[model samples]
Target: MPDNKTGPFLQGITRLLTDGTLGTTDIVESMHHRIVHPPLLPSTPIQHLITGIAGITYRNIKWSTRLIGKGIDKSLYKLAPFLGEIKDTPKKVALVSILNGILGDYLEINNNPLAIQMNLKNQDRDTSIDASSQACELRNVKGRILIMVHGSCGNDFQWNQEDHNHGIALAEKFDKTALFLNYNSGCHVSSNGKDLNKLLERLIYIWPVPVEEITIISHSMGGLVTRSAYHYGRLNDNGWIKHCSKMVFLGTPHHGAPLERIGNYLDTILHVIPYTTPISKLGKIRSAGITDLRYGHVVEEDWKDRDRFELSGDQRNIVPLPDGVECFAIAGITGKTSDKPSIRKSGDKMVSLNSALGIHKDPEKSLEFKKKNTWISEETTHSELLSNKYVFNKLASWMK
Candidate 1:
């Protein structure tokens, strides 16, 4: 075998191109079919012939594309080992991460190489916790561990935005081991949550030192993943969950993000229309993870047996915060003060303040975090939460 470490990730582009071509052909052919046989219109033999010919041409194109895609895929694999393991640049990582966040579920279903596998970030590349050769990541490792989870389209490296990383800073300050989880954010939070639970189980079993405490600091969609993981931990009776002591959420959209709702609206509108219906495929391109954010779904019960794209109101059974864990929330706002909680635009541009704080109008849906445990940061954007000194201070204080 050759040293083709990059093959696992870069090969995804071939599959992506093939899929894109097929999908584009589908949309175009659908429009052609609709035009030739308009809704509620009579059909003719000429139209049938035209449509059949078009269909055959499209099928041939798709078949050829698939064949070529497979050929390139095999070639890349054979050629990869000789290329050696080309270290992934930050730019490439960001591109791949963003791609996964948008079409992760699709990539996963299709077995595309681009789909990011959930793993613990150790040194340069990610390594599974249960590997025989444990990662010598830290010295004098303690039971106090901090798990960092980044949001949609984000990777563990993103936690260190602009040369400062909350996970590293907190670990240094508190003398604990900080482990960053890198996962495909486009998968359903429930799936990622379950995976994280399993990873933690293995981590605890293989830890160099006895596990005593675990802290999770999450941002954006990452918070939802963390919440789901805790629920699974308890549901499966995973013993490692007992060590989870504190969870800090930064700009997490506990209720739902307005942007995804808007995207849902667009998908709905396009789908309902006749001409634009086919184009709605672009809207439906959103991953299951993004749709789960339609209502901050954190479990299988929340989305199973339902069309995720349907404009269903929040019918999900309200899940309260995980019990026995001191949960702290930090809602960043673009405004100077958080006096206007009801204002739609006061949130950190991505998450509304009320949603970030888990303040649903329905009493049953509210998470019930104490006032002292939550902080509202002003003049901050969602992306700024990672490196913001104030946010880090609040997280450190909560841990203390």
Candidate 2:
């Protein structure tokens, strides 16, 4: 649901604009300084004059933006109640989800109302707001439960694309309840994982029926979150894990995504030059969740006390498929089965085959799924996996 205080979104934008203005001023001043005094030269007195003036100007701009932002917040708060129910339309949800995926931690730290709070929903209705209310909503719920977890920058509704929804379809066919995990994809995956553990615990407690079996079908980053949730659930002895029977991962980067690695590379390369150093900050603007994808990080220990933007190699802790659970993985390729090594390596044009299959050069790092449990889809893109009939067929076979 869209927050009644839609003003924070405007405030967020205003704050970003203010930040951009200040950042631009600094970059321009730095360029001027570099031009005035080349790399090897000593600091000139002219440099100090330019630096001091820019500093004072930026300070005033900062002060002014702060005042303006406060005023906007006050006005928006006063006017929010009259705006009626701000609908979470598809387009609006997409834009906001994308924003959160890019600046989620930033939004949370700054208390931006646009930040998404994780929730579980059934048929577009929330189920975790309270136990009694959830019981009423899920009065006819079944014992078998199938949870659908969507990828980054995605909402649970995106699963219902092309007039087809795998979650609803599977639930209907198998006579089970379907729940969707909707969450901010920009926060640390571990934090979301822990939250998911608590959510599952509460969900089952308030469920109208005793959950006989729990199965999760996750995509991309959602897979990492599922794995992390299970890890925490096991450590905390959460009852939800005992009911978990199976997990199906669709195009999950169990190892890491090459795109984020490339982003990290660019961030590092640009940071080397004075002219482009400021530009490097733009690369670093991606969310903490994105940085986690660089190595499929899913635990706090993996990212704690570390500079996420540093051009670091894969230093992620090895997390394997959970024990006593049937784990399955699926990778999609945009080409035929007979495609070249390059095509195979570029699985789905987003995640690679090896990463999706949890295949690592180091044996210990590999997730070691049963060979028969993995499936590869040909001539398919990452987004198409959601609606692909062939993919659904394979998933159905596994579900059966």
Q: For model 1, state the Cα shift of residue 276 in Å.
A: 0.7
lDDT of 1 by residue, 23-88 (tens): 999999999998999888899999999999999999999999989988988998877776667667
- Mark the 10 consecutive residues where model 1 has the least summed lDDT: 124-133
- Model 2 misplaced regions, further than 4 Å: 1-37, 43-47, 126-136
Candidate with the greatest TM-score versus the true structure: 1
Q: Give the TM-score of candidate 1.
A: 0.94
Model 1: which residue pairs collide?
2-81, 3-81, 4-80, 4-81
Candidate 2, residues 127-196, lDDT tens digits: the string is: 4432223443565789999999888888887898799999999998898889988888999999889988
TM-score per model over all chains: 0.94, 0.93
RMSD after CA superposition, every candidate: 2.1, 2.5
CA deviation > 4 Å runs, candidate 1: 123-138, 338-346
lDDT of each: 0.87, 0.85
